[model samples]
Target: MKSGTVSQDYDKNETDGKVGLKRRLGFFDSLSFLVGTIIGAGIFVSPKGVLEYSQLNIGVALCIWAACGVICILCTLCYAELGSSLPFAGGEYYHVRRGLGPIPAFITIWTLTLFIRPSSNAARALTFAEYVSRPFYSGCPPPELLKKSLAIGILLTLGVINSKSIKLATWVQNIFTILKMMALTLIIVYGFIEFATNPDASKPFQDAFNSQFPNAAQTAEAFFQGLYAYGGWNFLNYMAEEIKNPSKNIPRSVITAMCAVIVFYLLVNISYLTVLTPRELISSAAVSVTWADRMIPSWAWIIPVSVAISIFGSLNGGMFMLGRLNYAGSKEGHLPSLISMLHVRHLTPAPAMIISTLIACIFVIPSDLVSLTNYFSFSSWLLVGLTCVSLIVLRFREPNLERPYKVFLPLAFVVVGVSAFLVLAPIIQSPKVQYFYALLFMFSSIIIYIPFVHFKLKIPYFNKITCYLQLLLEVSPTDMFEDSKTE
Candidate 1:
């Protein structure tokens, strides 16, 4: 069955007061949503990984980064078509569910709510906190309380804004995104000028190209690691319902955002390399500031502020869309009903926002932004592979569904999808994350197919254990497993 033809009813008793979601986001807002989520700590921290991998040849490293951007763009194309066709909020959860069966859909949703989305937002928040505080205090910094409080504070502020009005939220998103892009542009332009005049600028392109990694495998490995830095290009697709004219805007936003980020990334790295030696760039934790100090000569004061603003904007965008995933699953009766309940006044899913935000805050309290980003990269890429496969499955199972942004060059998507899987496999080095993904899927399947579905399907002990553990940890319930009716 095609996704469009899937039944909306799932043993529910809904006959009155049913309403559709509010649509308030426009093309700019949607575009910001994509870019803001993508340009976070990855740009700040991933340069080290790239420099290490490319052995200081900033030009070649950028080419590899751009290559990854191309793959992500292809994935965004697939998502854009699917998102517009469905035009729902749950992002991948809704599409996967409609294409696959309820059980499998539940699993994808599980990974999203419990691990993927929440962890990412938390990572962003912590990065925001770090950048916000780093201006005055040097050294190792203060205790966890300061960072956690700041992280939670940002979450609460964004959550409240989102809960109040979709229009307000999108406007805020637009302003922040514009600020971030402008800041990046200024940095890139100024740094390029500095590179031209400075005697000790980056080595000639020939010298950079001649440099090699210790081994070919290591170079390939570093290239793949760099790919993880560009993971959030598809985040905006999750907000399909809120977007204006999703059919027209989804593809536009996805493609434009990808191009913008790629350009921003290439220029920023070029700027950084021009200012700092490859060794210095790799050694210092604050590469952006280093570039800013060297290039801006006059506006050094503005650089730290710019970094903070960029990180804040990125955090806001991630949280705004992440909540929608939970909301979408709830609407489908695959997640908790609370998640689906929009604040009547705010027109946003407040409960889901609160729950997701809390989880992010909790996770960010201890870990460094780089390590947390790596964790997000490994886990998110694994699920992304599954989402890609789900796309192929849906195409075969429901070929007749209307797609506004059809991909004519499907081979491109397939190749990129397979390549993405290859890039992600090495990072799944840990047993814990691997099992986490597996258990998350299995638990979601049970919730989607059994009791909530009114089927005689039986669940295994492992799922039961994981489910309770999740509940014990206060993770939002997976698989809107019950009807949205007053019992």
Candidate 2:
């Protein structure tokens, strides 16, 4: 592995006498982060899309949800092996670098950090703002400015907390995860109540299997909804270096979290259907809100408050991972070297976190987030599919790479096949101009990477600039390799 943009990731950086990021996350904290990241606004809103796409066939929709969870676990196991063996901050980027090559790796982190991640963070923040501000504007929608401001404020607030202490960030994640889980428990419990007291209301299940199955296209769309909701299944891998006992906990936590999310998702959707029939579920703009309205109109406020809190925890978890991605990229010299530095005393990537939050804030101001999120969505999945492919490549290429948890090669292959379908299905079914643009945008990173990063484009007096940022941010820099430049 000769030095290239991120090829150095395959080997360790010789110690530079500087303190690195402390491993602060235990299994509990790691599980909390994964669960919180996965159960975002998706479960609350996406059930409707799944049901609608599956043509109100409750049985098929449930299967799609379960299928998506299984697919995610398979894909995540492949990452578990990488997280344990490679154990770096960048997650997929590091795995791709070692197994595939530096260019693909650089392209992944670059496109994600620059576009996909920030846009995602922005979407989460905006949703959080809307939920929180809705009460105040019950007469009409809240002013766009109010929502954007609240969105930016929350993003920055989380950034500051992450900057100060990893402990604090994980603590916030844990509390939020618990709170959201409790909310989901309430939903599941009520669904049980609905079944016990009023069997007629649970019509979706009464003759669930009798409804005609959705066509192939509709089934794929339903699965896509599930996949979208399950987006952050791999988030824990990115912070492998920060987790305690990476080998055991990486696989254990990811598996545990996904299982819990699947149960919660399945039960919650079942709960929703118990109260609202297929027509009500599909017709409603928001599934949870409608469920709450019918189930307990007087206590309907609870769901909105819970959703706001859920999004809060999710945003915190996402920002933590987003910051880590930036730090990881910088560590590999794919991003500005300044971002790689850890806080002097706290050993946190405050600069990277803040920069990421700022970019997300910029994205929050946009009025049309759906268009923004859609444009970059396919590329995100494409990279994910490629990362899974890297797992297969590494198994043969580096059989001796000391895997703490080796995934079954066949399961890895299955995930790769599924990933290929997911990455291609939308384009092949109903091609969109944005999909083409996204492909161009994703690969364009290669053109920029070749000269600027791969060649280590030297910046005159960059050392002075790095020193200034280090002093201002109180961060310690990693030792750079001979071929590496400031950025």
Candidate 3:
């Protein structure tokens, strides 16, 4: 296996004299990316599944959320150290590439670009459309065509926003992040008021721990649901190359975002339990909407609107980071060289954004939210485990390398152990054919890598083909060509 250090890679980049991504994101922008990406429609929609899977036990469900929060924080610390040390655009893929090898990195990004990210974006887009159409639905659910159209429209809209300017995307993220926070704040305040004034509202907490315990499969599924809500905490790391003073801001943003999210998630769940019974929470398709209807009927419409805005912000953040990942992969020649180009005017990865958005739109055709979630969670956590393990490997392989931030070894082990459990628990509890399909999807990267990456295969007239395609797509030639490297 080929082994190399990130410092060596940095030296190569300097020797190659590459034009790099512009550093424009500051501490607050990075924080907004972290927080905004994480607080998506999952919190609004997944709680019902979590409660149901946990057998409607308020205590177990909350504990699962808390535990996932802790695990996420620990995992964030690991990412903090890696992001500060490497400060690259590819996030986990870059970390794993430098720490493990090219093949492993290729596999990570392959699965991510092909499956994980598109599925996630599609899921969020569908959720956004569902909530937006909820108030319009008189009897049955909204028409499938309408939902798909809305999903595609939002994806394209966010794709355009991100492709145009990072500054604009950050502004959208910041504004919507605050709006979503306020929405949560409203829920928390109302729930606390109801808990204080109405003694009957306190019954949910009276026997919170008295419910029947769930089986192992159910517990794993519930934990997976909670972890999905906490998924985006590490998104900022993907664009660490763009963050100002990433060494200082990466860890700071991660710690702050994780802390705030944990507190808000706990309070939000508490608010849900306070206002609605466990049975009510499990039965309701949209728990936040239900809370709003019961607690503030006059302004019940606000919740779905808030959710739509929140999911939109998340879609923006996801697309922004997804483009960066594609750029990173392309820069290293793991993907098509065209995708690595940064637009001359906007200084954004336009090709990457366009391709990712197109794939996400394709994913919208399949409306299996549950299967998408399971596939995303399993494959994502599996890669996360490998990435965390890469941290330990790098520490030993390059003991004297500069680390602006470092996670303690014990905590790193905890992240690895927890990640392993998260990856394997569902499979152990209840094996599914989809799990195998996910694995097959990951392994399929190797087949492609061998011909394209390992053997350096190129089709006849590949450049000519890309040139014509680029012109047809209106991609500026200056922005579509660069000296590509595979490290």
Candidate 4:
């Protein structure tokens, strides 16, 4: 059962013109992808939720933030081992398929494709639109149609960029990531200066831990909010197949990205506290924006503009990986073969990109930012936790398999434990009807899988449809190569 003994025919398929993902991404590209994807609108917006749940206790809120960072880093390490060992597309789906079985793998990608990813993309897109429109608003909230249109417009722009060239997409990601970091640096630097000059600025920290204590449920919910901000740390693994020297790069990128974010998050929270009291943070809808407005009213415009840029970068990263997910699923014969096709001229998965874009656009209509975050966090973490469990199973089942990066067994257990807590805590605290609806949506994938994949039941004209799609989509032949057994 171990990957070393499994006799990977996948390599042969790659060499036999059966796989088409190009290996053009390097370490920095992946690093930028991770940072840009993780540092999106969550940090700007979720502080309110985190502060509220922590009962306005600055010390407790900071602890929850640090705890979430630890959990995210641990999970990243687990993914590092898998990504380096497998170095494939599809990320969690591939890991689960290899360690657990195809059924779980199918379900993982099914939920991600149909719900999790699209919903997430829509949320980021909407956040981008909201921030972009903020400066233009006179006194009333922007029109709903205006927001939706802007969201769709940005989605289309990113989709086009991604469809044309991955290089172009990564370039966009890198530039925006650097810009975002600069913006954040400005906030942190200015906040520190203000704290140094203003004698009473440390008042908030004086009694940081003395505020009203939250119940266990509230603490868990606060941690969940922090986790939402830290969600995209694992995105680099989704394109592992495209990363150059993946065995080395995957672990390095994960470590670098996680460490950078953890430091930035801790500092950002400190910066927020310096300018605003715990109660102020709880009441503010946009913590970062409020900080900017207070710190420099003349330059207040920069906050919303930078937030829009931050979200644009996230949307770009999301679309870039989503297409790869569809391509991975198609390669496994779990989805229509058309999705696996690479554009002949551009060397991108055009059809998959379009499909992902269209689905995300549809999602924009039904959900708001907060609900989308909750829905995605609950369901996606359930699978993420399962994927981490797969690492443990594979360690025992495939002990001989080569892993360039190996997470310690104890740490892996902690990851699984934390993931379980995150998945269950919200439901236990206050079960919403949406949780059941999300569950129903996930389980419904089983019906489609059994009839199509498990039983291999052919629907009418399926082959012809795939053939026509192949032609229309300009799918290149699959690439095949011998699987390297050793690094």
lDDT ranking from best candidate downward = 4, 3, 2, 1
Assess every candidate by TM-score. 0.83, 0.94, 0.92, 0.94
Q: What are the Cα lDDT values of the candidates?
A: 0.68, 0.83, 0.83, 0.84
Tens digits of per-residue lDDT for model 4, 213-312: 8898888878878888998888888898888778888999999999999899888889988998877888888898789879999998888888888999
State in Å the error of residue 98, model 1. 1.5
Instruction: Please report the TM-score between candidate 4 and the true structure.
Output: 0.94
The Cα RMSD in angstroms, rounded to one decimal, for candidate 3 relative to the true structure is: 3.6
Tens digit per residue, CA lDDT, model 3, 212-234? 99988898888878887888987
**Residue 131, candidate 1: how far off, in angstroms?**
1.9
Worst 10 residues of 1 by lDDT: 6-15
TM-score of decoy 3: 0.92
Off by over 4 Å in 1: 1-18, 199-202, 213-216, 365-376, 412-420, 427-487
lDDT value for model 3: 0.83
lDDT of 2 by residue, 296-415 (tens): 999999998889988898889889998999988888778888898888788889889989988988888776753567766667777778888888897887666667688888887787
Candidate 4 lDDT (Cα, 0 to 1): 0.84
Off by over 4 Å in 2: 1-18, 479-487
Model 2's TM-score against the true structure: 0.94
lDDT, residue 12, candidate 3: 41
Number of clashes found in candidate 3: 0
